[model samples]
Target: MNDIRLYAIGEVARRTGLSVSAIRFYSDEGIVAPADVTAAGHRLYDVHAIARLEFVGTLRELDAGLDDIRRLLEGRVTLSDLATAHLSRLDDQARRIRSRRAVLRTIARQHTEAEQVILMHKLAGMSDDERDRLFDDFWNEISEGLEVSPEFLGLMRNGRLVLPDEPATEQLEAWIELANLLQDAGFRREVKEALHETFSSPGAAIMTSTEMVGVFERGGAILVRAQEAQRSGAPADSPLGREIAGLYSAHMGEITEIPDSPEYRAKLAADVLGIEQMYLESLEEAATSTDPYTRYQSLVAIIDGTAREAAEFMPFAWLSSALKAVASLKDS
Candidate 1:
């Protein structure tokens, strides 16, 4: 004891960059006990005590609680173990802080108080699982009684919309909009109607094992030709337009087992136009965002442009008339 050097509380504070009061608090709390008391009544810490106080100060800076520091100092827990646990706690706190910051940023950008509240509530309340379940419910409802292919169904399921833990403002807004759309009864009904019409139409049976392969191959070819014609800036009523329309009529004719006559072609064109209009309207409604980050505009444009090019072929009412015609012909 006589050979060892001792530091007063003031000296310890200066050495460890801690306040005298903090050192005194820790000492009173038995976190870092003094080595001994001098005859004059000053508390003194030995070299080992100084080192322990330094460690305790570091832990405090790392945001460790007093109780946890006491546990470490009392040898109830090893320094390595305590430090590892504290690091994990800090990491969890950091993640939470980041998530909160993301939400706050979104709130800050909101133009209206109602929007802010709604966005905050939505983002804060929904977990990833809950979000996923919402999409599952939507797809299940829309796809009811529909003969969607396994491959296509898988694609739909895999494209489930989910917000990241720390989502960007645009992504959060997009997700919120998507959720709102899913909850819309009118939108659901419209989508269901479209699906029903498409699947129950006359040419729907064209998706047969042998026919489907041919249809897909031919469909791809038709799209390519229409895209080329669109690129060349051909008018919808021009010869090029008729060529695209002819390609579609021939495809529908093969599918419906109908003769490709002018009357049949006119009816096919009408049906095609109706379906195209439905899709364009739906896309426009869903993608009505002014946000540049929303991918809806580009997606809608691509689909609309493709449909317009296909419409150039002028096969208007194919599905409805062909189905009725084929049924009547069968009856006769």
Candidate 2:
């Protein structure tokens, strides 16, 4: 050991990129003891000490603490074990950094201070479980006292509104708007009333069955035709519009077992229009996805369009006066 060549702390620092003082601190902490002391009292490191010092520098780069380094040097922990622990910690730190970056990007794009503050509070502090719970609670309230189909219930539960691990600006905005909509008391009341009325109406049983799928499919076809007519600039009271309207009215009459007379159509239109604002609000909440609210809106639109077309054929005075009175009463 005495005959082995040695390097001073300065030489070790030059080779390993560690400062002389850092080597001294590690030596003082017993993390890497000096191989020998010169007669004049300067510390010297042998080949083994040189290797240990380099290892210590590498661990320090990884942010390992003095105690951990001490344990590693003392053989109390294996290098592999220490490295695995450090890798786990690094992964957690990376996740946190990414999350913070996402939040900053979201804030940078906000149009108002109030929006920024609210989004920061809602999203930055929210956990995955908290987000899930919020959706569950909202659906519970919306479905309360309503006899929804099992399939519909399953869709509600599983169609989660997930925020990505690193959310984009539009996704953040979507989450914020959806959360706000879910919490609006007036919106909730209107949605509940609409659901209640739909499920309790005479046609409710038929509408909730698998058979309703056929009704929706037929209505979707009619809507496509109506959309074509609309794009061609056909007036709502034109022949094309009247043809689509007739198909729609016949379908409703067949499904509801109600006559397609002026009074029946007027009452149906009033009921359907009463829920129009709520349906529109739901569509807004689900604006980013066609599948989210299209089916529900299609059903409402068919009924609404059919009733309005039927009313158009009534005497001008009765159509204007009587329909307005019925719609106002139903809406209230």
Q: TM-score, each model?
A: 0.55, 0.54
**What RMSD does each model have against the real structure?**
13.7, 15.4
lDDT of 2 by residue, 107-133 (tens): 677665876566555654567798778
Residue 256 in candidate 1, Cα distance off native in Å: 21
lDDT assessment of candidate 2: 0.62
Best by TM-score: 1
- Per residue, candidate 1 scores C-alpha lDDT tens digits across 49-113 of 88888888888888889988888767799888988998888776765565566466656776648
State the C-alpha lDDT per candidate: 0.64, 0.62
Cα deviation of 246 in candidate 2 (Å)? 35
